[model samples]
Target: MSTQMIFDYVIVGAGSAGCVLANRLSAEEQNRVCLLEAGPKDRSPLISIPVGIGELLPGTRYNLHHHTTPQKHLNDRKLFWPRGRTLGGSSSINAMVYIRGNSDDYDAWEAEGNPGWGWKGLLPYFLMSEGNERGTDAHHSGYGPLSVSDLKWKTRSGHAFLRAAESLGHRPNNDFNGSQQNGVGFYQVTQRRGRRCSAATAYLHPVSSRSNLHVRTNSQVARIILRGEKATGVELLDGTKILANKEVILSAGAIQSPQLLMLSGIGDQDQLRKSGVTSQAHLPGVGKNLQDHLDIIQVVEASEAVSFSEALWPKLLTAMRLPELIFLNKGPLTSNVAEAGGFASSSLAGGNPDIQFHMTAVPTFQHGFNKRTCYGYSLHACALRPKSRGEITLDSTDPRKLPRIEPNYLSEPEDLQVMVEAFEMAQDILAQEELSRYKKKSLRPEQKLSDRESIIHYIRQHAESIYHPIGTCRMGSDELAVVDSELKVHGVDGLRVVDASIMPTLISGNTNAPVIAIAEKAAELIMQRSSRSFVKENRHTQEVE
Candidate 1:
């Protein structure tokens, strides 16, 4: 006989969003909530140590490295992508820069038919999640689940870079999450007491002992189990079946959210049939409209000798200073390398910022662990508004197998155009007198800005993802859309996808905080609906653009 203990909500993936949803949904002790993660507990010392994040990759302690099926724009190169498979999802291993994009981004979502997703609509949720070290009621809040604080370990280079950016006529803003996102400044991070404030730390750790919430690690969800047309529960990889009295929420993030959909027979029919997935819901755009921030990173040689390039690895050289950080939680270990970033536009204007910046203090082979030298700054930029879209499809019949992702990165001609423009614009920013004194240019591609074709070629050769993927299981009002405005999966009952995947378009800034806010909003929507009678969301008869 199949054993079953019903839950009010079954939240898959205990990442940043999952943790928040689980915590909030289970707050009503009467409701039964279960949060499952494929990865182990985040006990790795590297995860807490901000600088140690690099080493945490390449090993299972912090990463689940997946790859995209050869990207056409990137010379048919298969991109090696890493997602944090730990308790916090990418937040556990990410640079931890807190951002909410721009007001226009959320407004665009509202414009896209997700009525309550506008920046104004979601600002309170954003404020609620943040516990700003430098607190305020208008700009930030001091009490929140997620700890948003300034780094106690800012380097002279970090300061010099921002000062130089300001001196170069780029406006200096105190906070990116504040009134405006147009200026360069020391980035406020997701930190607590000088250590990395990963979502596992901020959301899960505090609620670990909650009996009302059942947190399961190392349990990968295969798919949402459907009972005829309603989402009844989820089937685990080990063949374990979980029954939910309420809903099965997929918080597996942008990539896996759609992957789960397709696996569970709720996806594009043609793709589903091709993969031998019997269609449960014939949604044509389950994994369509896939978007990610494609970035071109340039490394520079440090004029100053202070860089992690020389001392961060072998685990012993930096291990000597662990006590300084372990007790006080300050020093080299407490710094997430991308200490500074900004949003700006190319001289050629039309929209918000065509270009966005993410700068790291130390450079080691870009993404994962690279004990190699050549450390100064890893300056990165990606076009804020991309016309390109990609998809996530199953590699085989197995859910354990990572999906085929093709961000189709620069598919649209305009994507390359904006990126090239942003590239030249970044060159201009670095050319300023202040930055000129800090370092020498390390990697300059021969593509000059005299013509558009050459610049496109350069971008094609150099561009890689900033790892900001969203819009797979997009939320909109159309036949192709996977979910409705309330984030309920269309054609299915008792199911909701609350993650970056629900974004109809990519935001103009880092996707982390925006994702957190989405989770908070989802919790509100989920719990509120659970308590009251289910009123069918007014179906928008409009089509998706």
Candidate 2:
């Protein structure tokens, strides 16, 4: 093993949160920050292109490609959970939808005993992180690190999807993140000049020249090294120890943050003993309270060849647009497949929209891995808040081994009812007159939707995660909470978790934008704490002298 190196701050997982933390913490020259990423740099051309998600989502090159243990509620099938492992993390592989979720979602967090996490407290951070192309407004800003923009190009089917939703009295909303979030509209994306603006692209790359900021890729953290109840540093898989004089932050997202904590012997004492690991903090919530958005897709064959598909003609057409994408930064290739969608309340929901939609201008089979021969479009609907909760447990003590994930989807009967309502709503939108021009026939659910039992069965068989996993390392003052409102791990010092994993509950929409906003707020909290500590240390030194 090499000699131990020390730094003021060490951030594991150079993902969305890690990149933001690195940039903000290292802004002060006195603070030495080291960022470690398990994956390679985010330099692939495919990662820059919006359409490259088709290739990136299904492959293991830039993805962790984690799978859940067989779900009992869903016919004992294992669901694929692909998370980004590269420098940018999931932002490099996500669909780039810029959604902050419902404002009430944040308010609910505050209601649950978490102060300063409500919509009002978090809005400033969101504004500080966004550089929207549409300019500044009450809820947006034009001067931030991340660039949010309208799509340079969109599929004709996407427009039709919006019109269809409006035709059904869903309302036509141009901005989902504006004064209202309940309407059909085009989703602004995390893009800059038609290119994917991942967190690394927005925050990390800009400040990479800072002398105090050290970034190391392809370095996997084995476990956090603790002394008593305090985190002193981290041990990498290669047997190298990097001490953190100030703090060690985990930005490894929902799946891995708790796994790391457990692997480091900070979870339930009994569970750790079962894995043959010594117990440290004995926080049983380290890997419990797992929550995710389960999505069901409805595919319809298009009467016209307007959808982007793997069919011969569409493939050739996409290729022909490459020149336009390269030169003008505008073309079909610039389209984030899930171009337009809306938020609506299910019949069972109260006040806020309980169901969200994502309209894709292509037929996706098995999470876009299988190439479809037909030209079609798809509509995805998911319940915003699922009552069913799950957990993540260790398979062994080895850090290299992935934890056993059990989302336990559809275990709650209320969740199933909401999904059933969402499915019918999707069917209603597709049947509208606005979409009749493009719709040929319903291709999925292969069973008659007239019967409720059939709809329920289809949902169980087809429902998949929309890639939003959260709450494994939840934030709250409750006993099950792994972190507090300031994001510090419970019962442990010199350690914090800043990622989607800290969300007490999953928000009502896409998680990427909210995760960025969380990091922005976390940066402020960390800086304030550091400043106070410095003052206290200086005062003590002067008194002693």
- What's the TM-score of each model vs. the native? 0.92, 0.96
Q: How far is candidate 1 from the true structure (C-alpha RMSD, Å)?
A: 6.0
Tens digit of per-residue lDDT, candidate 2, span 1-545: 47688999999998899999998899889999999999999989889999988889998879998899998888888999999999999999999999999899999999999999999988877877888989878878776779999999988898888888988899988888998889999999999999999999999998999999999999999999999989999999988999999999999999999999999999899999998888999898889999999999999888887778777887888978898988998998888899999999988788889999999989888997887888889999999999999999999788889999999999999999999999999988888888868877778955348779888888889899999999999999988999999999999999999999999888999999999989988987988744334334434543575
Error of 1 at 527 (Å): 1.6
For candidate 2, the clash count comes to 0
Give the per-residue Cα lDDT of candidate 2 at 368. 79
Clashing pairs for model 2 are none
In candidate 2, stretches whose alpha carbon ends up further than 4 angstroms from where it belongs are: 529-545
Which stretches in model 1 have alpha-carbon errors above 4 Å? 1-5, 311-317, 347-351, 444-454, 529-545
For each candidate in the order shown, give its overall lDDT on alpha carbons.
0.79, 0.90
For model 2, the local distance difference test gives 0.90
lDDT of 1 by residue, 231-299 (tens): 999988887888899889999998889999899999988889999999999899898899888888766
TM-score for model 2? 0.96
Candidate 1 collision pairs: none
